[model samples]
Target: MKADPKNVLVGSHYLDGNHACAEGAIAAGCKFFGGYPITPSTEIAERVSRRFPLVGGVFVQMEDELASMGAILGAAWGGVKSMTCTSGPGFSLMMENFGLGIMLETPCVLVNVQRGGPSTGLPTLPGQADMMQARWGSHGDYEVIALAPDSPQESFELVIHAFNLSEKYRMPVLVMTDECVGHMTEKVIIPPAEEIELVERNYTDKKPGEAWPYEDTKNLLSPLLPVGKGYKFHVTGLTHDQRGYPIINDEAQEWNVRRLIDKVTKNVDDIVWLEEKDVEGAEIVVMAYGITSRVVQPAIAKAKKDGIKIGMIKMVTVWPFPEKRVKELADKVKALIMVEMNYGQVFLEMDRCVAGKCQTYFVGHAGGTVHNPEDVYKTIKEAVK
Candidate 1:
């Protein structure tokens, strides 16, 4: 279906990443937003608050991040495409219910415009420190899909992709962008409504007695039955049967949890997206994502100029970590170099994936800003030697 033109900002504009993300949500047909303002992320909420009303959508400023997360989940179950935005401190507050959203199979989008920190570290600064936390922050054994946008334009595009993936898989999806990218201004072109493809929630067609929220489909994605639709359905965070009833046993535990993990893992190739440049026959591969990916380009260029056959893989999807592809590249490259704002979080994943196949090195910066290109270049040189 084409987007409603009124909600689509169909033109070129110099937009900051946070505002661009809000426009992306609007273009993607998101009708409800619940968020608590936090630095490096408040622009998203402010934009949504002003724009939602004009588009016949709703925006709520919840009491806190916890309430914000809860509100979006409630909105999703009410048959609306919903989202929320936050920084690290607020992101941390949302984790408990984030797990609940996962267990209940809610389809919504959450944007984390990452800031420096263990706790309120640097609100007005950049940090890629939340990459690992995005995967493992919530308690439990479920997998999630996360996309990292490197620029304001990609921020506009990827948030739409996040929503599409969430609806298709019946789970929450995250746009894991950092403050540098979130606040950076760039040109974002929103295409015509018909040109922008979107995935609608696959609502179940079964009668009230036959519809079950957790019913198994061959593809592992059960269609959702929104409340007040005359459907006899149950939704819970407990270990549940196909009928969505609480079941306490090892059998039920494996039955429910495995499906949640498998749905993402089994189809990882389809879920992972990447941009590779000159990887073939390269001695070193530099892996980076979010704003760091942009920062590392000049370094990669310098390495190439200095006769180093250094390649790069700019991560578009960070979670369900492109294990197969990384393993494949690991087997071929002489060494792998990871550069990020955080202190080696994703670098550890690269090391594990390499697994003695090749050497691995990490260049971690403690996030007030992006890496110095010379530092990234120096690391690539060291890795190759």
Candidate 2:
């Protein structure tokens, strides 16, 4: 038996995207789920609320997404691995506190099952339009982890990784799905519960009163204890010192701010995630992610059969932008093509990462529609030449 990540002892079952996500969060050892009801993604909240009660986990439907996001932040520092799910509009509503989570360095999961949007453009339709927003929606400078899954099964396992990465890095992890995957039915074989790798927040093993509220432990991740516990720690949105107290002085601000940013940006290598295919000997490379990657699979296969040296890179973790891989490929490939459901979102990141190492092409079809594989085939084939 494999012993690295640990297997989940739970049994596998057929479940939809929404419920499968819930099961994944549960298997990840999430004991707190909070959110407001939003279409397409509403089933996620409903399923969590229903199942959470059965496992002694806590679930609450807040008056709005604002409260839902805030509740999850509090729950995380309060010492429970927590999550909140919403769609485009609700995700927008949660943005304010999402920023607060960044300032406070809260570790939690924010699942956005995306819908067409600038402002609720299509509630029941699918869109990958939120990709850029997930990284920059919140104000001030901070790094975010965004995971885009093509299927229900990937969504399940990705959420578990999202939570683990969030806690491990002390940053908010964003799970970006879409209306298509959220409501679509699919066969997801669960990994046994015991196989799951769970990372809980580091609470002090010292006697209750002996731990420092924020002693600046290793990795800048302080020892965290539950709220009701006797250890007293202050969590604030303002720049804070090692002791968890607000620090507004310039020098103090610099130190505090640097630590907050370094905790993530300084470790970009460990945070990047992607899937590469036929990349070993390729003249043209297609950079695709989320559901769009699935659309381009056939194009890649066809190109390969015809002796076209074309490759594909599927981004599983969208944010932190896969900088290293993008830079390396930009230097090596003849040209790079980025296909997505949004106009030039990931394209911009690729361009920035490339910095003129190679020509970059972007193909996008927004508002719940996508480009055909033939279109992608033509684009990549042209790019190869």
Best by the lDDT measure: 1
Clash number for candidate 2: 14
TM-score of 1: 0.99
Angstrom error of the Cα, residue 209, model 1: value is 0.8
Task: Please give the TM-score that candidate 2 achieves against the real structure.
Answer: 0.93
lDDT of each model, Cα atoms only?
Answer: 0.92, 0.81
| Candidate 1 lDDT over residue span 199-262, tens digit each | 9889988888887888888878999987887785787899999889999999999989999998
- How accurate locally is residue 287 in candidate 1, as Cα lDDT from 0 to 100? 94
| Positional deviation of residue 290's Cα in model 1 after best superposition, in angstroms | 0.5
Angstrom error of the Cα, residue 138, model 2: value is: 1.1
Candidate RMSDs in Å, in order, are 0.8, 2.6
Q: How well does each candidate superpose onto the true structure, as a TM-score?
A: 0.99, 0.93
In the range 1-385, model 2's lDDT, one tens digit per residue, is 1212222325556677888788778777777888899987998888888777667689998999999999999888877789999999898899889988877777899999988888869888888899888988977777788998888888888998898888887767899988877876788887655567678676678766676555667677666656777766676788778666887888877877777677777677788788998887789889887778888888888888888998889999888788888888888989899998887888899989999989888878775765688888888778876
State in Å the error of residue 99, model 1: 0.5
